[model samples]
Structures are given as structure tokens and as C-alpha cells.
Target: MGRWAVATERRRGEALIRAIHEAVLAEVVDAGLGQLTMEGIARRAATAKTVLYRRWATPFELLIDALGEAYPVEVPTPAADNLRTDLIAALTLLTDWMVTPAATAVMAITSERGRYPELAEALWDKVFDPRGGTFTTTVLRWYAARGRLDPARLTPITTQIGEALVFKLAIDNARTPSAEEVAAIVDEALLPALGL
Candidate 1:
């Protein structure tokens, strides 16, 4: 291809990718996962069905790509000096994410995981593990630097306490915890669990 032709093609490709991502989220939000289909996506995105087939082999692939593109996991900076403050900040960021439309997509994927084991593995490997892993590593490093991360006490279980609690509140109760609740989790649960 000529230089301008190559550039034009690249722009078109980028736009198609954006459209596909948007269509996936909109479809799930509007119609739920059951009604999400490749044909429907192509129609909503105003792209050729061949384009989607060329890029993604299955709805699982498309959905995973869209979710990853839409909700890039963000691990926040520590809030303040202490572990309590920092842990609360990290957990709070997670709480905020849990309530977003992107998280609704996540929940949908998770709910379907039992039926589609590969999809669950992909979601964890591609999306959840990277983001959650980074945050967990950051929290551990922060506490270790402060000489507060106890070797025996600060295991994966302890690290996940705050996040677990928040997720429990969101999943079991259908409510995101208040700031006070987050603080209580940090002060009463995470910090003590970490032996900090």
C-alpha cells in the first residue's frame, strides 16, 4: 500500500476497534449477555460481520477484548502515611470500580464462568489477575518498606481481606460499603490481619 493509503487504513482499523468495543458494552448493558451476538454487534457497530469474524473467533473473545479495552484496571496511589489509610484507599478504589458499568460486564462474565470454563480462565488471566495482582503487590511492597508487613501474618489471605470484604458487600448485599465501612474494614480487619 502507498504511505497515505496505509495511514488511512490504520485510522479506519482504529475506528472499527473503538466501535466494536463500544458495541459490546452497550449490547450487554441493554440486552444482557444472552442476547449478545456477533451479528447484533456488527449491526450496532456498523461494521461488516467479516471484520468481527476476522478479528475475534467467538463472542467470548470479543467480549473479553471489549471489557479489557473499556476497563483497564487502575491501582491507585497510597492514600496517606499509614497502612490503614493506604489500604482503605486501595480498597475504596476497588469499591468504586465494582459499581461501574464495566464491573457489570465483569459480573456477567463471572456469572457465566461456570458454564464456560475457558471464558472464566481468560477473564482471570487477561483482566482480573493482572489488575488485582498489581494492587496486591503494591500493597505488600508498601507495608514491607515500612517494616509493617509481618512475614507469617501477611499472606495472600491477609492481603485480600479488605478487597474480599468489599466484594462481599457488593455481591452479597448489593451495596458498596460507605467510606466509614471501608475504614472499619481497614482498621478492624486488614491492618489487624496484617499484624500492622
Candidate 2:
């Protein structure tokens, strides 16, 4: 193909790949990850099964891709004020994020992938790291700017808060992380992380 023709075809191919990803996400969201299959995804995406198999080797692989598509890091940055307030807002955002249907399912999937370190690593590298890292980076930044941040204080606070929120949601089956609880995390963990 000519240069222009090649570029056009490449773009079209990229669009098709994205469409297939979307179709898989829709299927998983509608029917859960177990319902996802190569043939099923091919039929839903109006593509060939072989094509999907080439892109992904297993249902889990495909599920991870779908999860990545659905749970991309789109959380907004919190407005600044002081460490406590900014972090509280950040933790609040994290709270809402955990309960999102996509995030919740992804967490469950990650938990299940405990045996497959490679898959778990991929999930963390692509999805979990970005989300968690953003918050960590944000907290650090907040402290750096204020010149009052302390890691000793901030670490425990954020850790406790995050652990509590996650444990409560996963084990306790809570719907939302309370504002008061988020504040506690910021006050406790986030403070020491800076300098306290």
C-alpha cells in the first residue's frame, strides 16, 4: 500500500482494536467476567475469534484488558489548602473510586489473580499503580509545597485509612467510606508521610 493508504489502514485497525476492547468490557460488565469467551467476544465485536485470540491468549488476559479499559485512572486531583484538607478530599475521592462498579470488580479480579504473579503484576503496573501512585504522589506533593509534610506521620495515616477502607469494602461489604474516616487517614497517615 502507498504511505497514505498504509496510515489510513493503521488508524482503522487501531479503531477496530479499541472497538473489540469496548465490546469485551460491555460483555463483562453486563454478564460478568465468567461470561467472556473468545467466540462470544468475537461475535459481540463483529470480528473473528482468531483475531481476538491473537490479541489475547486467555479469558483472564482478555478480562484484564477489559478491566483496564473500564477502570482507567480518571480520578480528579484534589484542590489544595492544607495537608489535612487536601488529603481528606483525595481520600474521599478514593472512597468513591473503590465503590465504582468497575473498580470493585477489578479489585475482586486482582484478589483472584493472587496465584498468577505475572497477571497480578500487570494489573498493578497498568491499573493499580497509576491510581495508587497518583494519590501517593499527590500526598507527597501537598507536603512538599507546604514544607510541613512528614513521611513518618503521613505513611501510617494514609496506610491505615486505605487499609481500613479497602478491608471494610472487601470484607465488611461497606458501600461508602465515611468522610470522617477519610479525615482520620489524612490526619494520621498522610501527616507523617510528609514530616509531621
Candidate 3:
């Protein structure tokens, strides 16, 4: 078979969904959320629009699924009680994800949430909520459950420190924070907030 024929081989199940997810994320980043369409995603994924409709009713639903698929879950060191290290790692994951197409699409949705409130709501309900809410939350909870951290300290404000600072620095600097910056956020902001 020719290279063209080989490249056109049909994808099914997980493979097809992965391609469609990637296509939606890329489409949102390249075309913006408001411009996203089934046709555009199908064109990008090299699949028929009908294939997209088979799984998702709308491009926004597809985009939310893509973001959820791409979102990283923080895995705390269960045996080791290194809160600082785990917190830094969680924020590092956030910084790494911040540079991805999925993250870009998420930012696009959140930035224009007023225009697309439902999309933003779905993003939180489907993506962020399912994935341990936010960076450092899982780690903090792990530490708390083990008595390494006080459960009382694991409040909403404390859990959000690392993410809020990471986002603020990224917005202010217009770039993803470096590893050193991620570490500093854990040490300076998150640890202090947790009373450690």
C-alpha cells in the first residue's frame, strides 16, 4: 500500500477518541472557543463530523472531555511525608500543563466565561472537580489524613494558594513559571499558608 493509504487506516475506540480530543483542543487554541465547530474538529482530526456527533452533542462538550483527559492528577508520596516536595511537584505539574494546548483551551474558556458561562461551569464540573479540584489539593489532603498536616488548615483558601500564585505569576510574567518558581511557590506561599 502507498504511504497515503497507510496513513488513512481507520482508528477505533481509544485511538479515535484521543485523536478527536487532541483535534478539539488544537481547534480551540487555534480557532478560539467561539469559533470551534464540529466541522473544524473533524477536519483537524481527519474524521467525519458524524463521528464527532456520535460521541458528543457539541464542540464544547468535546472540548471539556479533552481538557479532562489532559488534566493531570497529583499523586502524593504516600509513604514519604514530604509535604514541600509533593506540593512543589503538584505545582510543577500545573506549570507543565499550563503550556499545553488543552491548558490554552481551558484558559480561553475561563477568560471568556462571561460570554460562555455554561462552558466555564461545565469545565469546572467535569474537568477540575473530577481531577481533585486543583493543584496541591490532593497532596494537602493526603498530608492531612496522615496527620502530617492539620485537617483544619486544609481549607479552601489554603488549598488554592499554590494554584493562585502560579496563575498570578504566569499572568504577570506572560510565561509558564520555571521549576525554581514552582518550588518557591510551594516553599513561600503554600507552606506558609498551611502553617508549616
Candidate 4:
């Protein structure tokens, strides 16, 4: 292909991907994940079904990508000078996202993981862990830098305690955790576990 043809193809590919993403979000919101299909998304996005097939082997893959884009979480570096306060702030961001429509959709999609094993792995690999890692990794390293992180509790599971609590509350209680509850999770559970 010529240089101009290659550039044009790249631009069109970008536009098609964007359109597919938007179409997936619309399909999820309108029809729910169970009902989403490549044909429907292609029609919604005004693109060829072959285009989607070329990129994603299944609707689950497309759904994961769409969820990643639709529910972009901002991981804030908490600078509260103490693990408790910093963790509370960081955990609050996750707690807040837990109650959003996007999260609800994610929960719905994940619940069907029994049917689509790949969806379960993709949701964690593409959507949750990547965003969750940003906060957990940053906070752990920040505390470690100050020689505050307990060497025994320096694993991924330990870093996830606060967000895990928030997720549990969101799932079990069907409500966003209160500020006090968020703080309590950080201070009472996570801090103690971390030996902080």
C-alpha cells in the first residue's frame, strides 16, 4: 500500500474503533450485556461486522473493552501524610465508583462469567485490576518509601484490603459506603492488617 493509503487506513481504523466502543456502551445500556451482539453493535456503529470480528473474537472481548473505556477510574495519589488518611482517600474513590451505573453493568457482566470464562478473566485483566493497581501500587510504594509498609504485608492481597471492603459493602449493602465506613475500613481493617 502507498503511504497515503496506509495513513488513511490507520485513521479509519481509529474512527471505527471509537465508533465500536460507543456502540458497545449504548448496547450495554440499552440492551444489557446478555443481549449484546456484534451484528447489533456493527449496525449501531455503522460499520461492517467483519471489522469487529477482525478485532475481537467474541462480544465479551468487545464488552470488556467498552467497559474499560466507559468506566475509566481516576486513581488519585493520596498525600495525607499517614496510611490511614491516604488509604481512606484512595479507597473512597473505589467506593464511589462501585455505586455507579458503569460498575453495576460490570457486576452484571461478571455475574455471567460462568457462561463465558474469558469474560471473567478479561474483566479483571482489562477493567478492574489495571485501574485498581494504579492506586494500590502507588500507595504501597509510597508507604514503603517511608519505611512504613510492613514487610510481611507487602503482597497484592494486602494492598487490596480497602478496595475489597468497599466492593463488599457495595455488593452486600447495595449502597455506597459512608465516609465513616470508608475510614473505618482503612483504619480498623486495612491498617491493622498491614501492621501500620
Candidate 5:
């Protein structure tokens, strides 16, 4: 293949990876984790088991890459001048997406990764670590700009604001968080952490 054709082919292969992930995520809703397997994934994705095995040595490794693709959890560089508002918007977006079908794959991948070090490394490096690192940077920048930046304060700041929203859905099983709730979280919880 030509260089461009080779690149296109690789992109197609990556699409197959995504398809397998979606298939598995659907199983989580329909049947849950017990149903996950390469054979099941290939059957659902309408591809072949040999194709999946050629691309991945094991299912956990496959799931790790799926997490990266599922999470578009990039650092928000919003133009809102008020740092608090910007932070709230960014964090809200992050939590909102976590309730999606894509997130089912993320949870499955994370659950699997705990038992497999190499799989954990792949997911952390490609998915969790990068997004967390970027979010940390975004929040710190916002705080510093507001003259409220303190290294000791960052954890409390995010947890009180962003993490509560996450836990509400994770623990409380709420369907979706609202804009008003996000605003309240930032105002009542996050601002207090910054001592504002």
C-alpha cells in the first residue's frame, strides 16, 4: 500500500476497535460484565475473532484502547473570562459524558485493568492520566488567574465541585446532572473550598 493508503487502513483498523468496544458496552446494559468476551465482541461487531486476536493479545488490552477512544476528555479552553464559570463549564461537560454508553466501556475497561498491570498502564497513559493531568492544569490555571491558586487547595477545590457531580451519578444513580445543579455545586461547594 502507498503511505496514505496504509494510514487509511490503520484508521479502518482503529474503527474496528471502536466497534468492538461499542458492542461490549451494549452488552453491559443488556446483560452486564459477565457477557464480555472476544468471541461475543466479534459476533456483535460482525467481524471475525481472528481479526480481533491479530490486533490484540487479550481482551483487557483491547478494552484499554476502547477507553481512550470513548473518552474525549480533553482540557477545556473555554473563553469565559470568569475562571469559576469556566471551571464549572469544563467540569460539567466531563461529568455529563460519563453517563453515556461510551462510559460503560470506560467502566468496563477500568474494572478489567485492575487485574492486569500492562492493561492498566495502557489505559492510564492513554486515557485516565492524560485527561486527569489536563484537567488539573486547567483548574490550576483558572485558580492562578483568579489569584486563588494554592497547591494544597486544588484537591479540595475540584473534589468539592467536579467530583461531587461525578459521585452523585456514580453513587446516587441520577440520570443527568443539570446546569443549575452544576452552578450550585460551583457556588456552594467549589467556591467555599477556595475560601471565596
Candidate 6:
């Protein structure tokens, strides 16, 4: 028999992108931002470097794109009547996402933002900003628009309360907050600030 090359099925469309995203996140979490590279991601993803290049010019660009895709969006109650429940759910989403590889990669980028200012900027611009700014911002806005929350109270600081507390507790405790802790944050901290 003549020697022949073996062919394997290739990932395409959303599946391919999802694999690439997961690879980049794992790369950043495992190797850190300084060590992230197209070669590294492609190797982790089991794809060709040419495949990554076909979509992104730099490793950071691909990383940003991946982060944007992995980032979560909060879904508040449609009627906007359950502010506390919705806020708890919003903060719960944050806590849930905190344990993911993508969230770990985000922490890596943010912790080293001073060293990688451009990367941090891209994270904010490309990922967080486009995704409703913060965890509770969307829910808060939803309530305010429905007249459940006062619009004037939805300042930057107020909108950040849930996310800030969640991050602070995570940093201090060395773990993501639990469901009760998430609810406490909304009740004890966020609601008071919003004048609930």
C-alpha cells in the first residue's frame, strides 16, 4: 500500500471559536499573560497557528475576543418588580462566573494591569464595557427604567456595589462568595445604597 497522510475532522463555526476561546483562557490562566502566544493557544486548542492568524493579528487581540465571548450577561426579571431577587441573581451570576477559567484569566489581566495597561484597557473596552459595564448595572438600570429604582441613585459607585463587594470578599477569603454571601451583599450593601 502507498503511504498516505491521515485526515482529521476540523472544528468550524461556533465550535471552532469556542475551542479557541477556551484555549486562550486556559493559556492565560496556566501560563500567565506574559507567556500567552499564538503558538501556545494553537497548541492548546489542537489547531494550527495559521488558523489563529486567520482571525486575529496578535495573541492579545485573540485573548480579548475570547474574554468578550466568555463574559456573562445578567438577565433581570422582565417586570422589574423583584429588585432584591434580581439583584441577588445578578450577583450570583458574578459569583458563578468567578470560578470559571475565563474569570481567572480576567483576574490575571487585572492584577497585572499596571504592567499591561493596554491589555487592561482592551479588556474594559472590548469586554466589560460592551457587556453592560458590570454585574448589577443591567439589573439596576432595568429597575430604574421601570421606576422601581430612582435613576439618580444609579451612580457609578452604586452600580458597582455588588461587583465590588463580591470581588473584595473573594480576595479576602481566597474564594468566590457563596449564595448567601451574594444575597447578603445585595441586601446589606447594594439595596441600602439604592435607597431601597
TM-score, one value per model: 0.77, 0.61, 0.95, 0.70, 0.71, 0.94
Estimate, for each residue in 56-151, the C-alpha lDDT of model 2 and write its tens digit: 898668767766766534323344445566566666666666665556556656666755567667777876566555444456545555655544
Clashes of 1: 0
Predicted structure 1, TM vs. truth? 0.77
Question: Please, what are the lDDT tens digits per residue for candidate 5 over residues 1-196?
Answer: 5987876553256577777878756755555555567887778877788988987777666666666677765454444246576667666766777677766665665576655557557766877776654333466555565655655666644544565555585567555566776677777777677666
Candidate 1 scores a C-alpha RMSD against the true structure in Å of 5.0
Location of the lowest summed lDDT over 10 successive residues in candidate 2: 72-81
Kindly report which residue stretches of model 2 are placed more than 4 angstroms away from their true locations once superposed: 1-19, 26-35, 45-58, 72-81, 130-137, 145-148, 152-160, 169-173, 184-196
What is the overall TM-score of model 3 with all chains considered together? 0.95
Off by over 4 Å in 5: 1-11, 78-80, 107-126, 133-137, 141-148, 156-161, 169-173
Per-residue lDDT tens digits of candidate 6, residues 1-196? 2333224667789999999999999999899999999999999999999999999999999999999988999999899989999999988888899999999999899999999999999999999988789989999889888988889999999999899999999999999898889989988999999888
Candidate 4 weakest lDDT stretch, 10 residues: 72-81
Clashing pairs in 6: none
Off by over 4 Å in 3: 2-5
Top-TM-score candidate index: 3
Instruction: Tell me the tens digit of each residue's lDDT in model 3 across 90-127.
Output: 89988888889988888898899999999999999998
Candidate 4, residue 109: how far the Cα is off, in Å: 3.3
Query: Per-residue lDDT of 118-195 in model 1, one digit per residue for the tens?
Result: 877988788767665534446666667665665567677876777788878767777999899888888888777766
Per-residue C-alpha lDDT of model 4 across residues 49-86, encoded as one tens digit per residue: 99899989888788787778766454334542566666
RMSD of each: 5.0, 6.4, 1.4, 5.9, 5.7, 2.7
Off by over 4 Å in 1: 1-15, 76-81, 132-137, 145-148, 171-173
Tally clashes: model 3.
Answer: 0
CA displacement after TM-score superposition, residue 45 of candidate 2 (Å): 4.2
Candidate 5, lDDT over the whole model:
0.64
Name the Cα RMSD for model 6. Answer: 2.7
- What C-alpha lDDT does candidate 2 achieve relative to the native structure? 0.61
How high is the lDDT of residue 92 in model 4? 70
Between the candidate structures 2 and 4, which one is better when assessed by lDDT? 4
